[model samples]
Target: MSSAMFARDVPFERSPTTDLPVLLPPRPRERFGWPKLTTRHALLFAALVLVAAGAAFAQAPDAPPAPASEALTTAPATPLSVVVKWAPLLLKGFIFNIVISVAAMTLGTITGLMLGLGQISQNTIVRRLSWFFTQFFRNSPWLVLLFFAMFMIPFQVRIFGTTIPLPDWMKAIVGFALPVMANVSELLRGAIRSIPSGQWEAAESLAFSRTKTIWQIILPQCVKRMLPPWMNLYSLITMATVLASIVGVGEMLTLTAQVHAAEGGRPELFAPLYGFAGLCFFLYCYPISKLTQRLERRYNVKT
Candidate 1:
C-alpha cells in the first residue's frame, strides 16, 4: 500500500484523558479574615494602625537629605552620554576591539583549517605533528602564552642572529593566533568527521579533485555543522580581546580600568564605562548568534 511504503504508522493516540471531578482549594475570601476576634484584639489592631500612621507623620519632617552620590544620579541615560566627555577616546577603544577580533579571526581561520586537515591526514608524521600542536595549545594555559607573547617574544623572535623587525602589536597577534588556530583546526577536524563518509566517496565518484572536494563539498557541509561552535569561538575571541589590554592595548575593559584608576579609585565614576564595554560586546556578538541559530535550523543539526 502507498501508506505502507511512505506513510509512517500512526502509533500515537489522539483521545484525551477523562476529566475527573475537580477538588479545587478554597479561595482566600472563603477563609475567615478576622475569625473570633475578641474586644481586646479589636482594640489592639486599631491601636497598631494608629501608631503606624503617627510614626509616618512624625518621620516626615525629620527625614534625612539624600547623600551627594545618590542625589547626583542622572538616569534615563543615552549610551553616548556615558562617555561624551571623552567620546573620541572611547570610540577609538571600541573600534580597536572590533578590529583586533576580526584580524585574529581571519588569521586564525585560514591556518586552522590547514592544520585541521593535516590533523586528519593519513600520514603518521603529519597526523602526529598536528595532533601534538592542537593538544599543546588546547591543554596549555591561554593566559600564560599571552604574557609570553607580549614579553618574551621580543627576545625569542630573532631570525638568523638578528631580531625580527615586527611591531609589538604584531607580536601580540602572532601570540594570540597560535592557540586559537590550533583550537579552530581541531574543531574543524571534528566537524568534518561528523559528516557521513559517503559524502567523501560521492565527491570522488563525481571525479572532483582533492582540493575541490574539500572546498566545494566537504567544507560547506562541515561549516553548517560547525556554525554553532564557530559562533562560540568568535564570542570567546571577542572577550579574549581583553587579553591585549594587559599588553598595553587600550580596549574597552582596559580603558574602563584606566578611567577608574584615574578618577581617584571611584568605581562609580567609570562603572558604566565597563557597561559600555559589555554593550559593545553585545552589539558585535548578537547578530552572529542569531545567524548561527538560523544556520542550525537550515541544516537541522542538533548542535
Candidate 2:
C-alpha cells in the first residue's frame, strides 16, 4: 500500500460522550468533616498524664511518728483520758467562744450599718469621722488592739468604766468586734454605693426623706449583698475567739492548750487535742462558709 493509504487507514479520532462523576481520594472522604488528631494533641495528652503522675510522685513519703514530739511523752495526757476527765471544762470554753461570736456579730452588724450610712451621709463631718474610724479599726491588728483594750484601756479610763472589772471574754468581744464593725461597714457602704442613683431619685420624687428612702429601698438591696460577707464575718468572729484563749478567757483553744500542757506535748495527745480543736474550728466555720457560698449564688441572681 502507498504511504497516504497507510496514513488514512491508521486514523485517530476523538468523541464526546462523557457522563462520569468526579472522584476524590478515600482519605479525605472517610474523614467526613472530622478534625485530624495531630502529634500536638497526642503530646498534650501525654503531658497531662505525666503532670498528674509527677504531682503524685512529688509528695514526700510519710514516716513513722517521732518519740521526741510525743504528746504526754513526759507524763503527757492521753486523748481518751482527757476526754473522760476534761471534756466538761473544754465544753465551757466552747460555749464562751460561741457567746463571743454571737455578741460580736450582732453588735458589729449594727455598728457596720451605721458606718455604711455615714459613708453616704450628707453631713461631711460625719462621713469624715466614719472614714477615720473604719480605717483605724480595719487596719489595726486585733491582738494588739485587744491587749491594749484589756491591759492598757484601764490607764486611760477612756470608754468602759474605769473601776469596772471586765471579764477576759468581754474584753475580747469588744476588741475583736471593733474591726468586724469596720469590715461590715465597708461591705454595706460598697453595696449602698452600688445601688443605682435612679432609685434614690425616684424615692425623692415620691417625697421620701433620705432616711426613709434608705430604710425602705436601699436597705433591702444592701441586706442581700451583706449576707455572704456577714457569714464570712461570723467565721472570723469564731476564729477570733482563739485570741480570748491568750487572755486567759478559757475558750476552746485555751482549753486545748491546757490539755497540751498537761499532755507534756506528746504527739498523740497533743495532736488529737489540737486536731479536735481544729475540728471544732471546722465545725463552726464550714457550715457558715457553705451557706455563704450558697447565698452568694442565690442573691447574685436576685440582685
Candidate 3:
C-alpha cells in the first residue's frame, strides 16, 4: 500500500461516520435526587429550625411571660454576670458536698471491709449475718434508708456523761454510708472469689489461719481487682450525695436551688445555674471515671 493508504489505516484515521462518540465514564451517575442525609445533617437541620423558631418566639410581642420555675427558661442578656455573682456561694456548697462524700466514703470503706470479711467466715452465723447486712442495705432504696436514719436514729446519746448531738448532716452521712458499705462488701466478696483456688490451697499448705490467709495473701492480690470498682462506687456515692438535699444537707444542688430562688426566680437563670451545677459535677465525676478506666486497664480487671 502507498504511504497515504498506510496513513488512512492508522487507528485515529477512521471515517467520521464510523467514529464512536468518546463517552467519558458517564460522569459518575451524578448522585441525583438529593444527597443522602446523615445523622449530622439531620441534627444540623433540626438545630437551625429550633433557632429560627426561638428567634420568632422572642420577637412575638403578645407572648405571655414564662413561669420561671416551670419551663426551660430563656437566658438573660447577662448570663456570665449571673454566674460570676452566684458562683462563690455555689462553690461553698460544693465544698460541703465534697466533705460529705469523702467522710462517708472513708467510713463506708472501713465498715465494708469488716462486712466483706464477715461474709466469707467459716461460721454459719457470721456468714448469714453478713449476708443479711448486705442484702438489707443493698435492696433498700437509698431514700428510705435516709428517712430511717433521719427518723429512727436518736438525735442525742449520753456517752461518757456528755450528751452528744447528731446533726442532720451527720445523720445524712450515716444514711449514705449504709448503702456504700453494702455495695463495697459485695465488691470485696467478688474480688476474693476471683482469686485462684490454688492460692487458697497454697496458703493452707503453709498452715496459715483463715484470717491470716485473707489478710496476708488473698487480699493483697485482690486489691488490684477491688480498686477499680471501689473508685467507681465512690464516684456513684458522690453523685448520690445530691440526694442528701432531701434531708436538708445543703449540698451543691440544694444551694443552687436556693440561689436560683434568691435571684428573683428569674426564668432566664434556670439553664445557666443548673447547667453550671451540672458542669461542676461533670468536672468532678469525669476525671474519676477516666481514672477508673485507667486502673481497670492497668490491673486487667474488667470490673
> For model 3, what is the alpha-carbon lDDT of residue 146?
85
**Superposition TM-score, candidate 2 onto the true structure:** 0.69
Question: What's the distance in Å from true for residue 101, model 1?
Answer: 0.8
- Which scores greater on TM-score, model 2 or model 3? 3
List model 2 lDDT by residue over 1-303, tens digit each: 675575565543333455432333344322122234579867865675455445433532444666766634644333556665867777777878898889988888889788978978889999999989998888999888778767854433335654555576677777777888899889988888888889999999999998899999989978888788888888987887788877777788887887767755544455445555665676567767767776777678333
The number of the candidate with the highest TM-score is: 3
Provide the overall lDDT of each model, using Cα atoms, as 2-decimal numbers. 0.70, 0.74, 0.81
- Backbone N/Cα/C clashes per model: 0, 9, 0
Model 1 lDDT tens row, 120-157: 88899999998998888777777777777777765445
- How well does candidate 1 score on lDDT at residue 81? 54
Among all windows of 10 consecutive residues in model 2, the one with the lowest summed lDDT is 25-34
Scored by Cα lDDT, where does model 2 land?
A: 0.74
> Per TM-score, what order, best first?
3, 2, 1
Q: Write the residue-wise lDDT of candidate 3 on 51-151 in tens digits.
A: 54455445434537778884466544354477889899998888888888888899998999999989999999999999999999989998999899999
- After superposition, which runs of candidate 2 have C-alpha atoms over 4 Å from their true positions? 1-78, 155-164, 264-267, 301-303
TM-scores, all models, native as reference: 0.66, 0.69, 0.75
